[model samples]
Target: MPIKSIKKARKLIREKRKCVNASQWFCQISLAFFLAAILTNQLAYAFFDIAFLGELSTALQQAKVVWNVLMYFIPGLLMILAATALVMAGINGVVAFCYKQQLASLKRGEG
Candidate 1:
């Protein structure tokens, strides 16, 4: 009930809000990178396939096949990263919401 305790609680809530904002920004950046990597890999495979078919050299054909196989793996990696980011964002949101609710209860003298 003291003034100092209330001030400290407000300060802690403000810090938590800042952390939540930072986490949101990080999640957005990570998602952007995941999408970009997927798109780039797809485009690379398409272009390489066309180029390889046009030349038809033995070595080039083999390399193209290998590259295509590698491209297939990229989506799996992207999905994993995307899933991780989603979970992290969800957890951060829950924590932020709980903290906000606590602050509200404190204001109501219900803590």
Candidate 2:
């Protein structure tokens, strides 16, 4: 029946909306991660001139080494994660567009 088809179309529209929402969240999170990565990378570069390196205790020196390693490593990981999220967001947007087109065709009695 036409009513049944309408209900199904409505459901599809709801699903499309959900996908849009998820895509938006992924984009926002990706932006946040990208910003964090940039900040972390800048921090790594900014603190390289340790004038008091010789005055630090052994533990402090070890801590500095760990900090340097992590600062360099975490940004690369964050960038990768951000790229993944952006890709997911793009996929979701594409899915939502597909749902929208399907709903449109259903409205035209094409499916």
lDDT of 2 by residue, 16-66 (tens): 999999999999999999999999898777775553345788888888888
lDDT of 2: 0.90
**Clash pairs (backbone) in predicted model 2:** none
Q: What is the TM-score of each candidate against the true structure?
A: 0.74, 0.83
Residue 43, model 2: lDDT of: 74
Q: Name the runs in model 2 displaced over 4 angstroms.
A: 51-65
For residues 1-111, could you state the per-residue lDDT of candidate 1 as single tens digits?
679669967876996797699679769966876896689687877877676665568887788778787676776677677777777787788878888877887777777
Best by lDDT: 2
